[model samples]
Target: MLPFPSSSSSVMASSYPTRFCFNRECPDFNRHECYRPGWRLRNGDFADLCSRCASAYEQGKFCDIFHQRASGWRCCESCGKRIHCGCIVSASAFMLLDAGGIECLTCARKKVSVGPNFRPPPSFLYQSPIAEKFNDMSLDWSSSARSYRPPNLSGPSILQYNLHNRGDGYEFNQPTSRDKATAYSTEKQRGMNDLMGKLMSVNSNNHSSSILYNQKPGPNCKVPTCPNVNAYQPLISLKEGPLGTQRAFPVTTPIETNGHLGLDERYLWHKANSSPLSHLHNDLNSVAPLESKNLNFGIHLDTPGKYQVVPRYCPKVPYKNQVLQNLSNESVSVVTPLFEKILSVSDAGRVGRMVLPKKCAEAFLPQISQTDGVPLTVHDSTGKEWTFQFRFWFNNNSRMYFLEGVTPCIQSMQLQAGDTVIFSRVDPEKKLIMGFRKASVAQSSDQETGLNNNRESSTNGDAEPIDKHPPTEKKKSSMTTTRSKRQKVEKGDLSELKLTWEEAQGFILPPPNLTPSITTIEGIEFEEYEDAPVIGKPNTGLGSTYSANGRLSAEQDDEEAKDEAEGLLTSPKSTSKHPRHRNGCTCIVCIQSPSGASPKHGRRCSCTVCDTVRRRRETLLLRKKKQQIEIENKARKELESPNSDEELRQSANNSGTTSKNHEQRHAPPSKAQIDLNFQPERDEESLSPSNTTTKDKSPHHDETSCKPPSSSSVHSRHHHHKLHVDFADS
Candidate 1:
């Protein structure tokens, strides 16, 4: 007979006169015969079965004999042997694989070789000495508990919590199933009632209470009740009752059990307030192995709201030194500064080499007599170790040290040029630690001041004498003071500097009246200014535009002023063509008549603007005449040559025609040419006042006139005379 008679069992005993085998397929299922307890049920009572079925269950072959044709049969991934998965009896026979599919215990043990970190499941904790051989294999008992479900049952899934005899006493397995959440409330209530009844009976009479407790052991006395229950005294006796039935009783004082089981006033308080497994479940995977030498457990189960059993494999308590070291490393705090250097473009580039200062390397680093220095181990701020080739090269009869293979470290920190890296040494170990400071906007001014100070100290042979023990804050303040002094000196120099009007005028010039000629040099057209540059003050506000860098600010102001002056001179209206002139109006024409006036200026008009325009036109025409004279000379030379062929005469004629066309395209009209349109009698005017002839008749002109004036030459004489006057004036 069981210790605790469930409600259903009591009702059945009262209603039915006889009992039958629990298995429907048994031959004696409905017969009034002796039966034995088989598997545990959801109601926390054992199923009564005949001797035959009970014998098979004890031998772990009940599923093979009775449930052979059940639906949930699966083949082992390794052995190809079928295992019944639909029932709870064979739950521990297989293990689930991470890749999907199941592996039998034999195959699983062969694959997952146990290591020092492997932990046996809770089921193996209470197994006998014979089961110790299997300790090398770890099983996922929780997965098996989750996968098992009673066949054809609509109630909640059955949780398998096995009990194994360890020679001295029977020990309950740890409840690995997380599904206990569904029955926790009911289980807790039932456990409390049983505990109260036991306590009341024990208070009444100790010997009688022990007997009643042994006769009616609690069904809710699961593994989670008292984790260390076996440590104090065995809760169940190995001695058998009548018909070889096992009886469980509190071998020690029941009061001690209440304390260990956490069912006293404190336990009730914790139960109502907090859950024991809340934090444990979250940190389950992070728990370290109990065999670790560095592992420490600081948790105390006696604390309020901490009734949960802390496993041996809980998270380790970190040491004080380790915690402090971790914090310092994360913050990148340097203990002692050996030397520091700002990374140049080459050092930060993919070249993967860092140049070290000669003085600092000789003073702090190991003495390397050889050019190919030793491989040095360096630790970064994060305590990550790196190997760098510390070599030296000869330069200008001196040795220059370099650290090769620093590209990985530099890239890991995302450092670039202008960033400062500090070489530091920590005490005790005297290990070299490398730290870095990223370049920021505020550091730009400080960098220049620091460089100047370093140079001065190096020259005075006092670089090694500076205080090395000052805190970082003191060093920062000193750097700031130096920067401020440098800035003040620069400001004082700018405030005292002044420039006169003439001195300032030398920096900029007014736009000239003559249009710049375009000249192509190397496929780029440059505006060639031929006239004398006009010196004048710019309209830009130079006084307000002055900055800390006075020279650069002044240059910027000069450029701005030149652009504004040029914009005022080259107005769109001035560049546009006027009805009077053949080409676009000149700057002088626009200046004399700001409005769109069209009355032509006479050749005798001698205003300064008119004179400048006339001289410019004459210069252009003279250049054209010179070019024509050169081309005629070349043609004459070619035609007079003794070896001249017919092709040479034709080429001379072609060259003459081309020169005439080019002159017509580029030559500007003269005052006389403009006047001839209004007064036709002026066409016969002579170019030279010495000859009072109707025209300055050249040999070419005479030849052209005798030809009866072809349509193309009708205005050739007038055009040539016009070009000559324009060229001379220019």
Candidate 2:
């Protein structure tokens, strides 16, 4: 702005300077220079660093070069190699230890490679200062307070230890309780102090010594005490050495101990009160043990004035942590079981409504004064949330609660009638959770039977049993009586007859050659047979032979009858071979009795065979009439044509000769003959006198002189003659 610049200088000034080195500790960090790429950052961009710093980073000495003076520095217990735990660069290079140190990744891998059966030396397992004090207190209590039976607690007391890292030291937030009484008297306190002095003296020689204590005790306490036992304070100070400058490391102790040990019970008091970051230590400890006994943090006295480490069951460091975590999550998700109901047909039906008990609805579901109700969100066992309408319907002067829109959930779980649905609520949020249980097949079947019985009893009042005997006895008696009656019937005992009406009627046929006399009885016409009534064999269409019971006994007989009937109806041999015969043949020769024992029916009889025969005759007569009319039409068309007189005379002579021959053959003209002769008379009337004279003078005047008839005319004549013969025979 102070001076005008050249084009090149202006362009150079507008461009940005080369990025500075990403390492803040580098000597050239603020210098303007070209940068080389270092490690990739979380946003996927390479860190801009000067050449020297980039080279050191690639060599894997970035943390050592830059963070050498960081506070989180610890020596590995196994390899004795120093590791920087303060920065993310070396975060994956080391693992935290349960006692109070860090282990290099190399040593950790080596320890894990030693396999599950490997047990660490007793020196490696060190008890924390707090745990050591408790151990001393437990020893004193066991010796002096043997008869001091504390309150019979229903469950283990949970001690909350909340560790948070602040500026130089860690802050422990422990929950304080006021109801607990002082655990020790003056003598007990003096004994605890002496025991602690001895423990400190024994652990002072170890370089990795760590101690934690509270600077302030409860308002009633008189001696130094651990933060969790008899008294609690807001802040617990951790002292690692004489100068008390070292930071306190997280140490996990066994949660369960012998209930007889008064002070040992404090170990079970710790809850899940630690920060999320502290869980990493727990995860490492639980995973390191594999199959060996857990690395418990406690000291045991093997001999006088000598302390050694002993392995104990640590609940937090066991392999069942994952299982316990899952159980805890489940417990949190479903806190209280509100109510359960077996699904009815309507509950699981397509209607998508579930009926809830009145008390459960009022107590568990939200209060609803309106019928429209409120939309409720419910979580299933699978953790999927679903929204449903919770409403009530007024019924029987009371209210009935119903949950609607549950069909999708029911279908997803594949639940049906007779399955049980459980309703539960989460604790803090009171979230509604729906769960289901499938009903066993046996139980469902029994319920169905009960429902059927109840319906029957409700519909019709209960009926008393006719027999006084027990059900089994009654069943046996009825079966035996039926068997005896059947035997009697088979032996032809008419008094013990047990037959259906159809079967009984089939056995009584009308007397042959005798007519029934009709009489009026109470305005009803009855047919009475004068001759003795004859009992005939039952007609099952199988055969005349009967069993001892006079009934068709074998299934084979019915099968044979069916096969025969099918063959008669469908077989080609059943059809008539005569050309004149039509379909649906009902001739006397074709009709047969079902049992082959009845006589042929007469023509006048009003039976199926007679009716069929009459229909056939009428059909044939109609066909003949049509044929005659057709012939007359042809003759008229011939007459209308301008044919020669000789041709006309020839046609007239042929017609007259044919008529005379038919009359001679059938002296008394039959119905078909009469019909044939009518067409000839019409032809005779159509011919004029000139045409007759021409015909007389023609050469074909004799009866056999006419030209040979056409094949169609011959067929017509033969059909007429056959019809005449059939009529005469009938």
| Highest-scoring model, TM-score | 1
Tens digits of per-residue lDDT for model 1, 1-730: 1122221232232233345455544655546345566554323344555678767766666767876654345557788666644443454455433222455656766654633323333322222121234544434422442211111101001112211111111121122222221223234434534543443332223222222222111122221222221111111112121112221121211112333211221111101111222221221221111121211111010011111112111111111011113364432211334455656545766788898865445434543546876566667766777777767898887779888898898777656544556654432233555666444322222222111222232343322111112113443433332322222222221121112323433322212223445433333333333211211112221211100000111233454433322222221221222111112223232234433233445688886555655554454365448546766776677768857655454443323243332222222333343311111112122223322222322212233322211111111112211111111111
Q: Clash totals for all models, in order?
A: 7, 1
* Cα-based lDDT for every prediction: 0.34, 0.33
Clashes counted in candidate 1 amount to: 7
- Cα displacement (angstroms), candidate 1, residue 56, comes to 2.6
- On the 0 to 100 scale, the lDDT of residue 610 in model 1 is 58
Return the clash pairs for model 2, or none: 159-269
Give lDDT tens digits, candidate 2, residues 1-730: 1110011111222233534455656765646355555543212234455678767766667767886754344566677676644332443355434232446656765664543222221111111111122232222322331111111110111011111111112221211211011222233334333432332242223211111121112233332223322211111112231122221212222111221112232222111232222332322111112221211110010000010011100101001101111354443221333445656556766789988765445434544545766676777767788877777898886679888898998887656544556554442233566665444322222221111223221233332111111123344433432322222122221111223334333333222333545433333333333221212223212111110011111222444433332222222222222111123333232233423234445568876555544544454365446445654755786778856555544443322223343222222223332221121221232222222212121111122321221111111111111110011100
By lDDT, the best candidate is 1
Q: Give per-residue lDDT, candidate 2, residue 367.
A: 41
Pairing residues by index, what is the TM-score of model 2? 0.19
> 492, model 1: CA deviation in Å?
43
